[model samples]
Target: MNQTLHAIAPEKGRKNKSTQDDVVYAHIFDAILEQRLAPGTKLNEESLGEIFGVSRTIIRRALSRLGHEQVVVLRPNRGAVVASPTIEEARQIVFARRIVEKAVTELVIDNAEDSQIDKLNQLVLEEQECFSRGDRGAGIRLSGEFHLQMAEMADNPPLLSFQRSLVSQCSLIIAQFESGAKSHCSYDEHFELIDAIKKRDKSKAVRLMMHHLDHVEKKLSLDDDNASDDLKAVFSNVRGKK
Candidate 1:
């Protein structure tokens, strides 16, 4: 445990509480996933301690958890850094997602009720608002939230855990995408998904889910026309200091 992690919660009962650690973990995790903390970005104990108002001990513990989840890396003698996913890693992540998400949608439609469908419809509205406001960060989160919402609908703990991993890896790939824009899976498709779910059309929901993930993959890969260096620079420049 790094000494700095403790300072963030000096109040009595706050320092030992895991709730604070969860907060620190989520804050840093969101920063990395949203591209605010880029690949290879060094998570200096001092800096994170200041940002989250926690001790280095707490930050290290949180980072250790991220590494276990493949979200962050702990380099020997180098402390913690954001995971710099390779091109091959990105491809595998999306491919795995295509399979898992398709099946997850099938499960959702199998078990979901009208009220759950309504909740998802409401979420899509919130997603559109985020996009309209240029809150790509919020929009992307909402885009992914759809899958999580579906997972909750399915109520399969083991599969939900797997989906969580897939979501994290997908976030890494999204962070490396050429532009910091929301995905191109137009909002209408979300409406279609809700309508299909409302109609209890499981196969249609599965098909729509497959197509949605496909669109996500294609958007990430659309820059075959651009120089790899240009795209790499897009990620590298916005990333952390050497």
Candidate 2:
């Protein structure tokens, strides 16, 4: 792993009960999404506790939560590691995302306020800036957040929660099976979807969202033989150090 992987630290501020666990979980989850932590990389509890300035108990809690979400695997006596999703799981995730996101885009068209639309546009702008700066990891994270933000704007908490999980899983799948060196989400497609929503063109928004997801799915090399390997070399800079 890269040395930067050791840079998982809690934010500087007040601490509350279980906040440490949340911080640790977010760090690991973000690392996975950013491809800094490869699938099947062993998540040593003691090492993580040291890295995040937390206790082993807290690390265990965080790992357990990730396991529950199927983002990591917890093995008997083997501790935890990042989840290596199968090709079937990957397909299912993309399918679920299309269903949920189509609903979300339609709902946003129906219910979004001007301010919410503005906020989404701002996020896309920031995402474009990240891409322009060659910050692929930041761009990828921001791209996923854009979808989550849209789900929030849909004003359906249950669906929003589901989208969050699905998006996170998609991040892992992309990291594992993405083909070539292309970006995951197209900025132009996102812009078009936002425009459709802004115009309250429900049919267009739904159509654009589905097509956008299809484009994303088509970028994965799910059949690659080496796709199952733990790509530690790709993220060799990530060291679970403090």
Positional deviation of residue 228's Cα in model 2 after best superposition, in angstroms: 13
Over 152-172, each residue of candidate 2 has an lDDT whose tens digit, in order, gives: 899998888788778778867
> CA shift at 217, candidate 1, in angstroms?
1.0
Candidate 2 lDDT (Cα, 0 to 1): 0.74
- The clash number for model 2 is 8
lDDT of each: 0.67, 0.74
When summed lDDT is taken over every stretch of 10 residues in candidate 1, the lowest stretch is 1-10
In model 1, where do residues sit more than 4 Å from their true spots?
1-18, 178-183, 221-242
What would the per-residue lDDT of candidate 1 be over residues 56-110, giving only the tens digit for each residue? 8887888886776577889999888778777667778888988887777888878
